[model samples]
Target: MIRAEIVKLYKTVHTWIGVSCGLALFIAFYAGALTMFQEPIARWASPPAVGVEAVSLEDAPRLLELVAAAYPEAREEGITLHLRGHENEPARVTWVEDEPHEAGQPHGHVHWWATLKPDGSLMAKQEEPSDLAEFINDVHMRIGIPNPWGSYFMGVVSLLYGVTLIAGVIVLLPSLAKDFLELRIGKNLKRMWLDAHNVVGITALPFHLVIAVTATAWGFGVPLWSAQESVIFGGKQKIAMAHDLERWRAPPPTGEAGAMMPPSQLLQRLNAQVPDFEPKVMVFRNFGDKAAAAKFAGAERGYVGDTRFGGVILSAVTGTLIKDNRASRQDLDRRVGTVILALHTGEYGGITIIWAYFFLGFSGAWLFYSGNLLWIETRRKKARKEGEVEQSRSTRLLGSATVGICLGCVAGLSLTIVAAKWLHGRVADLDAWHAYIYYAVFLGSITWAFAWGAARSAVHLTWLCAAFTVAIPLTTLLAWAFPMLGMWAHGSAATVGVDIVAFIGALCFAWVATATAWRVKNGPADSVWSIRKAEGRTAARQSVAIAAE
Candidate 1:
């Protein structure tokens, strides 16, 4: 009965839907997995990770002055204060500066940052390590493509993924019971892998569904509202842009003389004025005037609490609360967005959540790998039996693609992070080096796949990639072994957070390395291979009725 249902679904929409979204899903999971360790990766990118000390409240005002001097025109653009620093964090006062320029040419723009000394004085030279993180984020967000192109591309792929999620669930809804928890190995190799795939799919159904929908929403958010709703927008992107928090322009100030309040005081005033709120960023809406409004935005990292000010607009000169949305909106909407963002990024539950996210993300990637293996396994003896000419070329290509693209991405990202750390200070154009490394690795991976047989390189490249990523945190640990490179233990939570995450990442990499070794040596001859269950005869039998429907 279960076999009949599986065959039926295969004859219907199941195969097509999965294959259609498979590529996009692969990219998203691969990059999103990297995003799981964003903060730690960020710390690793900060070369010679320096220890941080707590900034005294008394020192904020003086430090603000030094930062202001460094960025005199900060008033014209914006000045932001970062209240927290990690173990290897650089205390940089950072902001974006819109330079003056004529039409058709970009006015000069710089996302400026300056590292501060331990004594509360600003470092003479400026450094912007966060750019590396942002670049990785952009790649994840929009495939590192620019403007409408990248976004539009990502949006289309995400929509397809979302559709696959819905369609997949519908197809699987019927057999969700009998076939679940059934993993058969060796009766028929294809049957075994299909069962393993079904089991993994069913178990992670909730997570996979969430990723699809959230990625869709994130990718299509702007287009759905602005482009599609242009009639409502009166054909003006500016109005839509204003509604979107991401929109920014050099809004000129009235230039009238008025006593502007300091951010330190503003932060305190914000907490006092709005109970249960924390400020993420304190911004002067206008750089030059009395009516210059201050906007503070924040929310608990996970979807646990309200946004710091919940989109409040406040008087820059005085802490007059303007707009607050603490309790007015639908709870479901808030939770949905927050949870989606948190879960997709593994941020909803803090460290535990991050670790869990990393595990699933990798598993999701492996699911694809195994799925490909199953496909290839099916065609192998048949192709040889019928001769290559009679065999399907499509399956062969997908087989190559699955191995090549997936392993390629892993190699690319690993190389990119290493390049970020190694190339800093040595290169005149550090940011350019960052970009070059990522693209080179990505392109190189694809080329390698075509040149070398996909199957052979998949195993080799993954181990190499795993080693590269693991090296980052390991290098940091070794570098700090004796308080070398001006490193000393700082009794700060943020610093501790950095070190702890690195250790965890190292462990994860070790696990991957082991998995790689197992795959290479013993081989996943059957669909489901577990280190723990290697001894049993037909013991791998567990299936979800999910797909059997």
Candidate 2:
């Protein structure tokens, strides 16, 4: 027979660890889910521009010559030639120039895109691309907290999360076979929620394990690297990393100008040499010099985990292969690391895997939310008797926090996404405003939840979530209907998919709000989630005041 004390011990460990890390994990998973569609969302938010077709591949050589002659910095910095005509790509050629700043201070970059005018002249303009996708990714990585601290904070949380996963399995082990898949929906609300939570937890355990390991590794990556350099690598880590980086770096420019190979001929050469490589963008360094190189960044056919760390470097003048770092050619250690990263990000298996990860992310978020609710319910049962009217302070406080943080994240993300279209050209720095708007709504919702009780605030914030999410599609509709409003709506499937998903999300939030409102009104009065408890407390206070008067 299983010992009662052992079960109790593991249950306590699981509960405490889960509660401490629940809020951060919720934010991470929800934002992470959205990041599965990061590129699509970026395309959806991007404004129409010069477009990739404006400068055809045949005329790219002329454009390169013009840019090299006009802007000497670009030749050294490298110029990116966009192949895919995604909405986010402003033109056929783009590059970044470092902004002027004091030597010791932090510097910024100015983004520039160039295209050929109707005449044969060079038309270049500096414009910032939408960073909404990157901002969502930041939230996923850091939970909206600033860097260094955020990384350290999440590193600790991820460690605790892995512990909780182990403790949870131990706690459920005695009855694992009997209760694993049996989700009983009945009058016992806590039992029902517990059953549902267990089902999801056990089903997605593998995915969670992968996430926990990868997240912990990445969260403390810098510190870990430092430790490894000192301890394991004997201070040779940086040198090794520099050597690895040389594969991606272009050769130094020779002063003598060379006869540059045409981009069309270079592409043919690439096809002949590396038949399976599909390059998304060709980055040219030292464009007009003898040592000019073209770096092709893209995926090779039938290989996973090759998007970020794979590609080939070719001589820009002669179209000769200079370097090959494709997945098949990577060292075993580097290849394993790349695969682990891809597994965490769901970069393999194409669109179907992307959707699977999206749902898994949501499931993970709900697991934490449900775990919080179960904790509150367990406390309520232990703390209260049949005659008790007030819930425990601990449970009440946790309830309020749970409702506040989770719903606040939802409402904040929705509102910030809506602002992408609504405040585009109207704001001086739309990127900064994205941060401002998200934090404002997120903090405001938490304050509202504390001022009102969890019972009332959950309903209000959920409705707010629905409204803001619905506004995403409505904003797009307005842009399409009335172009005079200075907004745009791209008809591409990727952009339209964003609107459709948001509309569905809005409906789900509305349904949740309705259900929560009903439970607050009709559920048990002694519980923290019941509005009648708050009402009874107010009535008792009024009676005491009247008696005193």
Model 2, C-alpha of 200: deviation from truth (Å): 1.6
Compare the candidates by TM-score and give the number of the best one: 2
How do the residues 1-549 of candidate 2 rate in per-residue lDDT, one tens digit apiece?
A: 668898899999999999989999999999999999999999988988989999999999999899888888999999999999999999999999989998988999899999999899999999999989999999999999999989989999998999999988888889998997889988788898899889989989999988999999989999999999999999799999999999888999999999889888888999999988889899999999999999999988777788899999999999999999999999999999989988899877778999999999999999999999999888777766554567888888888899989999989988998898889999999999989999999899899988898899999999999999999889999999999988889999999999999999999999999999999999877778898997887887788899999
Candidate 1 segments whose C-alpha is farther than 4 A from its true place: 1-12, 48-55, 65-72, 87-89, 113-125, 144-147, 184-188, 220-223, 230-254, 260-264, 284-289, 292-294, 300-313, 325-349, 381-396, 481-549
Residue lDDT tens for model 1, 1-549: 436675466434556656655655666677777677776667556654432234454565455556655666776666655655553345434566766778788675756555557665676334455466777777777766786677777777777666655655556667767787888877476788778877777788889877777777777777677665567656676755466443223234676756667666777787787765555556665533676666666653334434422445577777677655443342566556555565566644556767787778867776666666666667655665664323255664675576567666666666676666456666787777777877787777767655654445555566666676665555546546754343333334543454565456556656765765575456543212222223332342322244454
Please count the clashing residue pairs in each candidate, in the order shown.
17, 0
Give per-residue lDDT, candidate 2, residue 67: 89
State every prediction's TM-score relative to the real structure. 0.76, 0.96
Q: How high a TM-score does candidate 2 get? A: 0.96
lDDT of 1: 0.61
Q: All models: lDDT?
A: 0.61, 0.91
Model 1 lDDT, residue 41, Cα: 65
